[model samples]
Target: MLNAVIIGCGGRGQIFAEYAKQYPNEMRVFAIAEKRDYLREKMKKEYDIDDKYIFSDYHDLFEKGKIGDVIFIATQDNQHIEPALMALSAGYKNLMVEKPIDRDLKKCILLSKKAKEYGAKLQICHSLRFAPFYRKMKELIDTGVIGEVKHINQTEGVGYFHQAHSYVRGDWANEDKSSPMILAKCCHDMDLLVYLTGSHTARVSSYGLGGFFSEKNAPEGSSARCIDCKISDKCPYNAVRIYEERPNTTGRGAVEKEGFSNLEDAMRKGRYGRCVFRCDNDVVDHQVSNIMFENGATANLTMTAFTKDCNRVTRVMGTYGEIVGSFNDFEIYVKPFLGNDKKYEVEKIESGHGGADTVVVADFLASARGEKEMCTPIDISIESHAMCEAAEISRRTGKSIEIADIMSDKEGALL
Candidate 1:
């Protein structure tokens, strides 16, 4: 069986360990590295792993654990590159890292080069690529059923509820702590656009703003948490009404109990610091990007946190036909001809993104054993993340940035 080591024992890390349990024949989570003692102990009990294999530092695991065949790095956004580089240098044969490679494009390229030099099989974790629905959709497009793609428009509605849970109050509140929203939330879209066009982006222009959710934007004389905030009843961004559908229910809602009553309670007993409004939360809550592809194809991407849900809406106009689809549902419409009747199809995919995480892990194990090719390679993910970084730059500069220039300048190198 292929042995794996996990760095970071947070939610995603726990998910990986559980995924391993379901793939007993192909893999096993032999060890994990987490700095928090409570999490280390919790993971040990939850997974029934020996205490010796749980380490306080990932480097310690690399130094002491049996030679790991694969390493999965699921650390926070800013902490990904360090553990990834360490795992690679320590002779791991397979590596799977979460999206954006790193907020710093330069570091992504450097990691790619180093993985190549060491002959390690590297897979960047953009799990949606492995999802059955998106995979099938991509297959249909590739088969020419949708014809030559001429233009594409994709919408990623982050939803105010989800944004507050993930961006405003969640782990990714500060841009400095976890890359910008573009990289944090929309990297998947960037990858999808690249995968669909079958060509690299030529140029990009973007604009965005943190228009709605903030202390200044919040109603007057309001507290941070939903329960104690006086305006929780009317505030659009209140966590209780927005997320859990209960403005009065505190502590047992979607977020931890500590942050429910007020910002003071949040600071005293929460992961995010007391400076909820003052922390470095500079990431945009809404953004739009216009892109030109190498084959004369163009795409428009709109991402908004004020939407009502967390699904993507995509419309593609090709030379021969046009197609529209929704990520939340399996409904798709294709208009092949002007006078022809529209064709509707219902797509059914398995749960958990149609088992994307399991499929990707299986592929990683298979490819590492020289058994097959991987769908999402290190290079493609790097290129997509590079585009994301470029879009962030374009958003800041308010100018059309040439992807070619950005790529050539290695502006993708670490932040």
Candidate 2:
């Protein structure tokens, strides 16, 4: 059996631990490292991990604990770099790190080089790449059912209320803490597009802003708390009301940390935990990107935080046919238009993205054991990461950015 360790006992860390437990016969969670005292204690009790195996700092886990065969890094967006490097340098042979690698392109490049030089196997957590629905779509496309793809469209409906709670007024509201919305949230989408199209995005154009999630846009005299706000009944972005009606729903807060000392304090302050419109949420709530594939095809992407519902919609168009689908529990639909008539195929999955998390972890484990190839490699992730950064630049500068111009070398491309 391979010994394993998980850093960060927050939500993502917990999920990784659960997966590790599922494969107890193959791997075991031998240690845990977390910064928050409550979370550390919670992990101990929740996972039954011994106190001796817990450390306040992740580096301390690597320094003092027995070296695990593989390390799982699921920390916050801006906090993955040091622990990853430390683990590799400490002689861990395998690593499965969460997506985007790092916010800083230069640092990611340097770490990639170090991993290659040190002979430490690396697997990035682009979970959607392993989603069964997407995998089937890739297979169909490869078999020419989608033909030579000519155009693609991807839409991510980041509900307005959830964006306010988790992004605008929450932990990742600030770019300094997480990253631009493109990098932090939409890297998965960009990477998915690149992976399916099998082409590098030659160029991109973007436009977005902090339109609706700001104090100036809020109704006058409205309290920040949706439960207390006078407009709670009519306002579209009411959280308390929404959650009360849909208890089992997953919000962005579910995926991210809120960073507020208390929910009541946020409501009173009206910035971090308060009313959606009244908070100091400056992150972009809506954005669009147009990408030109190397094969001269184009893909359009839309991200919005002001939707009545939440989900992702995708369509791939080719010379002979087209494949269209949705990821948010909607039925997957494929239409093949071959001049005679249109044929439709619909498949319903058991989980969101059709068990993406399972596939991602299983594939990584197989790759670590040298039993299979990576569905998403460092080089592919680098392309998606750069695309996200460049799209942000385009949105800020109001200009088109060329991928070739930004990354002219293989080293740069891997970043």
* TM-score winner: 2
True-structure RMSD for candidate 1:
3.8
| Superposed Cα deviation of residue 344, candidate 1 (Å) | 7.2
Q: Give me candidate 2's TM-score against the actual structure.
A: 0.90
Candidate 1: Cα lDDT at 327: 72
Consecutive 10-residue window with the lowest summed lDDT within model 2: 247-256
Off by over 4 Å in 2: 245-272, 339-353, 409-415
What's the lDDT of the predicted structure labeled candidate 1? 0.74
**Model 1 stretches astray by more than 4 angstroms:** 241-268, 271-280, 338-354, 411-415
lDDT of each: 0.74, 0.74
lDDT of 2 by residue, 1-415 (tens): 6667888877677777766667777667778898888778767876687788889999788877346677889898868878888888888778888876898877777777788888877777887788776777787789886579998889988776567666776666778767888888789889988988888889999999875666777887677576578877777667665444443333323322444344444344434336776655567888999899888889988988877666778888988878777766434555667554343344443434457776677777787788998777665687888888889999999999988776665355564
Model 1: how far is 387 from its true place, Å? 1.2
lDDT of 1 by residue, 276-329 (tens): 342346678889988899999999889898788777888888877777778777
The per-residue C-alpha lDDT of model 1 at residue 336 equals: 75
